[model samples]
Target: MNIGKTLFAQVMEFVPWKTFGRIIERHQGDAGVRTLGCADVFRVLAFAQLTWRESLRDIEACLAANQTKLFHMGIKAVPARSTLADALTQRDWRIYHALAQRLIARARALYAQEPSDLGLDATVYALDSTTIDLCLSLFDWAPFRSTKAAIKLHTLLDLRGAIPAFIHISDGKLHDVNVLDVLPVEAGAFYVMDRGYVDFARLYALHQAGAFFITRAKKGMDARRVYSAATDRSTGVICDQSIRFNGFYASRDYPEHLRRIRFKDPESGRTLIFLTNNTSLPALTIAALYKSRWQVELFFKWIKQHLRIKRFLGTSENAVKTQIWCAIATYVLIAIIKQELHLDASLYTCLQILSVSVFEKTQLSCALQPDRTQPELVSIANQLNLFEI
Candidate 1:
């Protein structure tokens, strides 16, 4: 009988440890270490995320339980809760942040060839944010309101392969629209956002930078129509028109003509008013681009459910940021593995499989293979609603 490294070790093989070292050196992450080094800290945190460990004590208990295999897993010693807590609250979170960016670049390169069904070959992105609530007593500094504390995760997700191109962590008190000022706008790319991000000045900045934006129009928006374009009502497009802002600030912020479309959802029967800077694309295509914005919402839901972002390991700001960044890294690592191995299973399914088999001694790809011995029939009823009472 032959025993090998655990699935967790195999999965971590994709990380560029050498480049990771340069980031650590730049941050002085491991200026001095006696027992628990930065790598060990990362291994523990990544393990906690992958296995759904809820608290610091839970992580310590699990690592202690597997103490004999700690060296094999590249851990020098099992850290006590206090030691791990100190590391989480003191270590520079930029190491993991830079690492996540590196992984995002690799994932983007791998997904560069992915086809976009939105009828264009340009880079399309969805901008959105999710609020993670925290206990006011435990995290007083994150003050969302007089009674509540929380943090906001602003993410810009590329539609291709549902990959995150940018991520920013901010206080809950900060408005979503403010994130636009910091965004590195790429020329000729289209950004799809919700109504919460409507700021004429920022939108004008994007326009001046040669980028495009699509967002829902705010209620009572003052605009004067210049020309009306023909639209196909059969495709739910009510009307399309070229218009310019009439309000003093609105006009001064954006001096260019904008396009507005009135659309009605055939299924929901809900009417939607869309605003954009691009005038050439078909009305339906603009509507379709906005519809893709929901992908970022799905991505948020996925990470919150599968990863350990809700139940934090520590209460300090640095600890919270570090854990969240590690969670992002783990997510990107899985994406890289899925693409590199060409696994046919969905990402959620792959995460579920790896969760239970983290310690299994087998190649990650081999472990992910379809079982030939038992050909279980997938119920067609799940795919189709056979009957509704």
Candidate 2:
């Protein structure tokens, strides 16, 4: 199947085009006649993200230069900059959102076997959000400050393979803690977070839904230690205790005892207090799970550096959302490819290879994977290790 096919074409084989077509139909993405439909726009935007195209003109120029390979790449024709911009502005962004959700489901199934590295059997999720600043003039819809505008990406990251389980886009004014109101709670799963999301009311909501949470407790939180649990001091776990809120409002909000872990980081020598509803796991594992929340932070940093979300191809709310969804779909797609192909190469390497070799008429495996029949060059002991976790 890889014979005589471009790497880009083969990479796209993972996409469920028929399903996306249904999504487009449901959204009526092509209700009106146009030079560029929603699907075409997605392909172009995905291509731009993969190839690191800086602007609309850059995308148009690149496609124009490779005009002959358009069909093979699934693009019927090269789109003019104006036409593409119009599509981005008019087409429903929900089409791409649905597509991205489908890709996420498929990717999650493929990566279900991945370990969380916590050595715990329960499902662990890292909850966080990152803000992307925008110019107030260009993005009047998203208001961050008196003069600045921005958008926030609220993400729930499944630590296994770092696949995003849930994503919500909102104006920068939206508080991170507010995301808990819309967060889908799965029973018995562990949700880790920082103190910014430490609202006792929302935490109780999660508790009521039969979900567990591990988050840093805010300073000056009034709580009475009801029972002190035994702990090993050498593991950096200072003390593990069962605590109940001492404040009237806090007690009313969470009318239940919570497990509290006090840990001192041997490396940083910083004492930390962690709050969680899960009482089964060891205090060390709880601390380690909190430490793993950094993966979501790294996930944010990685996509911002590699994807096109930092810069806007269009100014409309719909356009920006569509672009971000497509970028998410692209990231999930590449993650799917990496798993299916079983390539030892990192994602950064895979993207680097595809950036320049997308149009080449070669087998995807041969192009992405090193030749087994030939002698291979030795990899250095220390390489450019980027985002391995």
TM-score of each: 0.94, 0.94
Task: Evaluate model 1: give its TM-score.
Answer: 0.94
lDDT of 1 at 80: 91
- Least lDDT summed over 10 consecutive residues: which range in candidate 1? 380-389
Q: How accurate is candidate 2 locally (lDDT)?
A: 0.91
Off by over 4 Å in 2: 371-389
Give the poorly placed runs of model 1, Cα more than 4 Å off: 1-3, 372-389
lDDT at residue 206 of model 1 (Cα atoms):
97
Q: Tell me the tens digit of each residue's lDDT in model 2 across 1-389.
A: 75777778888888999999999889888887557888888888989988999799999899999998989998999888888888888998889999999999998888888865767667889999999999999999999999999999999998888899999999999999999999999998899999999999999999999999999989899999999998899999999999999999999999999999999999999999999998888899889999999999999999998888999899999999989999999999999998988888777788888888889888776677865576779999989779887
Model 2 Cα shift for residue 158 (angstroms):
0.8
In candidate 1, what are the lDDT values of residues 1-389, reduced to their tens digit?
Answer: 12488788887788889999999898889887666667677888888988889998998898898888777677778899989988988888888899999999999999889888975889999999999998999999898988889999999999998889999999899999999999989999999999999999999999999999999999999999999998779999998999999999999988989999999989899999999999889988998999989999999999999999998888989989999999998888888898999988778877888877787788788787656587778877557565855
* lDDT over C-alpha atoms for residue 247 of model 2: 97
